[model samples]
Target: MEEIKLEKGDFRKNIAVAGLGLIGGSCTKALRRTKTGKIFGIDIDSGVLDKAAGCGAIDDGAVDAQAILQKSDIVIIALYPRETIEFIKDNAGHFKPGTIITDTCGIKEPIIEAAIKYLPKNVEFVGGHPMAGNEFQGFDAASPELFFDTNYIITPHDRNSGEGIRVIERLAALIGCRRVTRVEARAHDRIMSLVSQLPHIVAVSFANLAVGEKDMSVFMGRSFMDVTRVSVLNRELWTQILEMNNSNIIDRIEDMIDILQKVKNALSEQDKNSLQILFDNAVKGKRMCLY
Candidate 1:
């Protein structure tokens, strides 16, 4: 990978963010730290825009997406999955030539494909996903340190310009992310399906199994709490993620079910040898994840 060249106080382009939720608000807060340029925020929800302004995340706020994009040198598409694609199509013409666009959407394959089709020829759309977030949602949950020491993945298409990619890396560094990796869009979705999407599914499933049971409260313990902690995440966002990456997620879930069935058979038969093997293998596999 080539080193990105950026100097302190060198970035002087106005930035606009097309959403004022957790991801968008966090971008605003991070940009403020750089003292680079004026930040404008846009949201369909006026309440969210007002809240972002109140939090000092942006210099100005508006409900019109085009109006914001018109004045921005760079635009961050932080809307939900479906809305993100639509926003690009609806406002592509408003962007200045050579304006760099990036997104914080979780799934990349579908979104990047759509961007390639609908985005203006002069504008660049690079897919970015920061591997850090809390279960909480909304602007109130946004923090300036959200990306600190986190891994940020940027997936660029074939048409992406070299300079455009550098702009994104600089933005990630400005947000305090210490590590950045570049990957293809499809590869990103597949890898995340196993590491990120499957875990959320398992957490939600575990939580649901314990709900509405007469004796469930008696069996609750710290182990259950630790495992189901992320089950408290916003349902709307998780639903979008699951649906967007349904095929990859389903394949991963099937593989997990196979492992669970093996464990169940070992326990039911009181097979001590099988149980010990499973425990030892699990420990070894988990230890490999420490790096």
Candidate 2:
């Protein structure tokens, strides 16, 4: 872990972002807004790259990932879980030595493992997950303010260099994230399973159940809309995330199911005492979250 000094002044280095969808497009736009770097976008879909260019999200767009990697000082991966690994394995050799690489993957453990196993030792691959997104996808949904006032988590492994982590932290700050927290990859995945992945699963399930029933529309209200808002998220993206973090997600799901069973039993037995106990515990736990 060498300590590399970041140059002060305008960060004019060329940044290549793979996958010109919401996350990549937002990153490019944010970097451009900072006037810090020249942004280049790469996507497997030429249409997405074209759209990103048309939106002025990047200085240039290319379908050839290797070419983008060859010219980039930093590479930001904003692809799906499997695609992110494949992109790194496919184009990592093309990256310049000492180039800083980061990703916006939801889960961290698998990505970090892939980076360690596939990427060149000289290139720095830091795990970054910006805890911000809308229920939309594609370049059209991108906003420079996507990361603003958000919390960006940097999951650094033992192999990660301090300088690499700092570079990622600075990038989060540059994108206007209010806080950056460093944690282990496994910790990140586990916590995210409970907080993000499980909630999304519940939301999708609720939406699916509601849609399957007759007269469901008549029962819908603002509360339903607020709860299931993320149910409208791109299924393809969510499928990737759910499958990638299946183990942790399944654990959380089982825990939630157990909790639900307790509630069901208490209600079925007409146990007001048990119901009150559960309600009290819920309120106490929620109160602790006020901080």
Candidate 3:
């Protein structure tokens, strides 16, 4: 990787954010409230770009990423995990020297590894995860305050420059993140697999259980809706993410199976003590998650 001298004060000259979906659009909305330079947006859908620009999420829009990225000092790739990797590999050579690229991709290791391998030596890539979102999708559902008080995790690589990391951290602050922290990329993946990805899988599974059930909507309420809401997962993105962290996710799923099996056996035997213990343990664990 070649080290290039960046022009003084070209530090955060401009920003280009690709993929104007919920996270990307919300990021743009938040950054627009700051002194950050002109925000440029890139997406395959011209309609999305037009909508984002009209809604003030971006100052300009384009389908040609290289065209926008060439003039930008920072680039935020708010794309899916697989698309994020391919984007880096495909256009790495076009990124301006000293430009810092970061991503909102949920999983890290694969995207960061591919980016580290392909990005120009003059450019830097840092990984960021804003632990926030809605059950909704698209730019129309974006909110300027979406990430307010949310946890922003940064996983910086050894090759990353101090300036690059600071710039991203500044962006996090601009977007109203309540806390900013760092973790190793692999550990980030494993932990996220358990906390984030596994829940989505479990939700989808629970939803599937109702596929053929009749007249159950009458009994369904906040609890079922709350638990199964995320089951309406982004098929493409979650499919890749769940697969990427399959080992961690599978371990969690198997654990859930064992717990459920225990519950079934205890109920069948009419063991009040066992049932009490199980419910008591669940109550204790649930209390641990209080906000």
Candidate 4:
């Protein structure tokens, strides 16, 4: 593989970002803020391309990605998991040799597999996930500051070049990530199932419970709202996410159920002592996680 010439605080490479939705758009905006490289945007939506260019988040954009792939030194794919795979498969032939391709997919294992199988041998793929986002979706909801002080995770394969990993780490820092850590792809997915997927499941289920209760809206408070905020999920996107990572998520769900069962049993037995202990443990756990 050819070496990518990237210097500290200076990346003059042509960086093409495929998919200009929330994560992608926010990434583009953050990259533009760095003023380190020429950023190009790609989206199926012509209007989105215009909006991205109009905001100066991109030097240029196009619906056709082949042209951009040919010239780009780095490509950040921000499409959905399946779409990301398909995009690579469809455009595998066009990427320039030594182009470092990475993706912002929620689950890393499948994306890593797709990259290894479909991409050209000369093309490098680093699996990445930005642990930052809101319930909102699309470019209109994206903010350049979205990644500020957020955590970014990279899951690199053994075949990946060391420089390619370093380049992504630097990009994460430039985009305002407070920390950039690397983990194995399978471990990354399992961890996301516990921290990310389970939370969404709980939020959506709780929200649905509220929906079933008449007059629930008037009684809603901050705690309830906070717990259910992410329930306003993109169903299509989440369906795919849940399906793709169902095995891990299912294990997490069972673990959650066991905990909930303990809480239920304590309440049923009118054991105030057990309830207090459980609440205290939860409080301590929350405090411990505040790094």
Candidate 1 per-residue lDDT over residues 242-275, each given as its tens digit: 8999999999999999999999999999989998
Best by lDDT: 4
Clashing pairs in 2: 11-36
lDDT of 3 by residue, 1-291 (tens): 122333444434689998889999898998887777789999999999999888787889899888998888889999999999988998888899888899998898888899879987899998999998978998888889999988888898778788787778777777888777788898899889777987888899889999999987988999899889899988888889988888888888888889999999999998889999999998998897664
Name the lDDT of candidate 1. 0.86
Record all residue pairs in model 4 with backbone atoms less than 3 Å apart, i.e. clashing: none
Q: Rate the local accuracy (lDDT) of all candidates.
A: 0.86, 0.86, 0.86, 0.90
> Which of 1 and 3 is ahead in TM-score?
1
* 94-115 per-residue lDDT for model 2 (tens digits): 8999899999999999999999
In lDDT terms, how accurate is model 2? 0.86
**Candidate order, TM-score descending:** 4, 1, 2, 3
**Off by more than 4 A, model 4:** 1-9
Better of 2 and 4 by TM-score: 4
User: What is the alpha-carbon lDDT of model 3 when measured against the actual structure?
Assistant: 0.86
Clashing pairs in 3: none
